[model samples]
Target: MIFHGMTVRQKALDLLDSGANGADVARRLNVPRGTVSYWLHMERSKRNICPGTRTPSCHRCDGVGLAGADYVYLLGLYLGDGHISQPTQHRVPSMMITLDDCWPGIQDEAGAAIHKVFPDNATCRVRKPGCRNIKVYSKHLLCLFPQHGPRRKHEREIALEVWQQELVDANPWPFVRGLVHSDGCRIINWTTRMVGGVRKRYEYPRYWFTNVSDDIRQLYTDTLDKLGIKWTHCTRAGKEYNISVARRASVALMDAHVGPKY
Candidate 1:
């Protein structure tokens, strides 16, 4: 059986019992180092457990496999705009992805994707004064997204593990679709050009993905290359990379794979 799925304190004690360093647990769980220290002290002193504390009801079955469309899509979403966080004083371990509220279809898609990965867990959505978010509570989330840690995506060396690379290579469209949905935009480009001695205006569709993480950007572009989709990248003023797919043929392929969000 899994050694986790207990409350935060229990998980901390278990990790320590398993010989994991307190600092490593803190970083992995995105908790303050002091909090880990406190848990260790409390466990050592054999203090009375909190009255209401209980182990979570775990419906987890076999380990989640990574070779599925849902997993790849979720992976792209995480690489783009998703985040996982440790439990707070009033929360459970959760993973959340917030998308622009304007794209209701994309919001639904994100929720569906989350459900696809964690079929046993219930996914919830929030819509109000800000973007819409799809969130779910599960300690097993970290098992699926081990790349998770403290810090922004750009600050970390984000690279797919070997199994993930193989899965992504096998089926890349859904992964690309998820990343574009999260961090890219599809728009119509308009420009004027001299046509037969007269100025003419024409409109063309394009897709642009912008991110500060060079590794993620490279990963995206490399995936596009593997799919034979043409793209180009340029650096913006503030070091942000803009990867664009605007060529007629490239846009056609994107239309088939990464359509507009909403």
Candidate 2:
């Protein structure tokens, strides 16, 4: 049985080396496509065929254009809750964004955005205790996300580059939506009101974005100001760490574009 397996594997590799795809090799060798794919991957690793050798599809290095809306949305997510890490010296770095498991729709959106930004790369989801991490590996992540550095995002200075600002300016709603999806929320507050000499209970909806990074909050408010959306700083636990959009007009605009996260 072992000799037969070795012969089949060798045949499969030979077929693959002759310029046939995994599907074609599997069909010809009467093996499962997944088996052929595994063999191909193992063979590449053995030969040290690193993915980093491939020409990076980077906007900075290759002068390639980004999917503007997707990039801006991803930028927002990264600034809010995303992280980039290099696992080892040899492997490329990966970018991860954690979203609550209850919001499968938001998870799908985040995955789609990552795929659009790095179409040539593969993305996977890693499940944690209460959230799912959508991640993609690439060598050019630093070039794409210049905010990555040695310290935590809130502890370091965060600012957008000129080109990134241009993209965000052109597509503000998506950027806001991304940020809200990550670290912001829409809630309804209730209060008592007197109407016609009678007491009544009324509820109003508002949007709130909480971020520890002052620069990140500034970026959010600056975008809001450009859109003519009124916002104020809300003090929480004796710290002004929240941006509130309680005005009816601003809430309506947020509802129209970004609604609550799914």
Most lDDT-accurate candidate: 2
**Which lDDT tens digits does candidate 1 get at residues 1-262?**
3233348768877887787888999888777788878777566446432211222222233443543787788888888878988978734478889888888888888788877776656788877576977888776667667778889989998888887787788879988998998899999999999999999999999999998889999889999999999998766786658999999999999998888879
> lDDT scores for all predictions?
0.79, 0.89
Candidate 2 per-residue C-alpha lDDT over 1-262 given as tens digits, one digit per residue, 9 for 90 to 100: 2233888999998887777887988788888888887777677667655352224488888887799999999999999989999768747889999999878999999999998989878899999999999999887899999999988888999999999999999999999999999999999988998999999999999999999999999999999999999999999899999999989998999999999989
lDDT of 2: 0.89
Task: Please give the RMSD of candidate 2 to the true structure.
Answer: 4.3
TM-score of 2: 0.83
Write out the backbone clash pairs for model 1: none
- Cα RMSDs of all predictions? 11.4, 4.3
Q: Which lDDT value does model 1 have at 6? A: 47
Q: Report the number of the highest-TM-score candidate.
A: 2
Give model 2's clash tally.
0
